[model samples]
Target: MKIYTKKGDSGETSLFGGTRVPKSNERIEAYGTVDELNSFIGLAASYELSESGTKYLRKVQELLFTLGADLATPPSSQTRIDRISADDVSFLEDAIDTLEENLESLKNFVLPGGSQPGATLHIARTICRRAERATVKCANVDDISDNCIKFLNRLSDFLFVIARYENKHAGVREETWKGKQ
Candidate 1:
């Protein structure tokens, strides 16, 4: 099928079950930002990552697709798909714990940079936060899944730790934030 479906030309788009709403709808914003996060994560993964890091990023990218799809679908729709669960949040926690083991204890906030991949991961982290906020707003007004917000929270933490890991793997030191006096 041709990719161009002029359906959204009127500033409205359909949710998963063909319920149309403004493109600016909270649901669209939520899922769209998740899609943005997925793209940046994929970018981070394209760098010289270790096999484990690569594998982990691949898993997260898949999860983001699921999240985006879930967000796109209205809760009342008949389309049944896996929504975010506590187990997904737990996986993120496990990853953060694993990666944190390799890094020094944090005494200060981190700068959003290091190796190229590390910097990109920071970008992804910020996007994840935006996506989380958007999802929260959506959840506030709609019957969305609560686990989606929880997953984004844990995933942001996971991204921060992985950024440190990427920096360490590249032999680049993390920059701790210091006030500009």
Candidate 2:
């Protein structure tokens, strides 16, 4: 099938249930950011990382797809899509706790750079924050599930911890930020 469905050429797109909205819609912004975050996660996964790090990232990518779908389908639509759930948020929290066990407690903020994968994870974390903000903005105009925002919030923390873990395993020291004297 040709991927070019010129239907969106008019600067509009269809939601999951065949509802059409402008590409600038808040739902589009939220899901687009989620898609961006997913791509960054995939990039981070391509770099050298522990087996567990790669595995968890894979899971995160899957969850991001679910979130994107949830954002794409409006509550008024009859389309059925799996949404971000409390369990999904819990999964991120659990992963954060596990990764943090191997990381030193943060006494100060750390700069966002390290091994290749670690740095990529940091980039993903920032994108996750943007996704969260976009999702919140979308919620202001639409009936967004609260768990969607919660998952993004916890996922940012998870990304932060995992980035530190990746740097630690790569033998890279984290540079803590010291405010100007």
TM-score of each: 0.96, 0.98
Q: Write the per-residue lDDT of candidate 1 for residues 12-122, one digit (tens) a residue.
A: 999888899999999999999999999999999989997768988999999998898889887788989888788888989998888888889988899899998999999
Look at candidate 2 and tell me the lDDT of residue 143.
88
- Which digits, one per residue and each the tens of the lDDT, describe model 2 over residues 1-181? 9989899999999989998999999999999999999999999999889988988999999999999999898877788889889999999988988888888888999999999999999999999999999999999989877788999999999999999999999999999998997
In model 2, the number of clashes is: 0
Best by TM-score: 2
Q: After superposition, how far is residue 89 of candidate 1 from its true place, in Å?
A: 0.9
What is the C-alpha local distance difference test score of each model?
Answer: 0.91, 0.93
Error of 1 at 56 (Å): 0.8
Q: Lowest-lDDT window of 10 residues in candidate 2?
A: 72-81
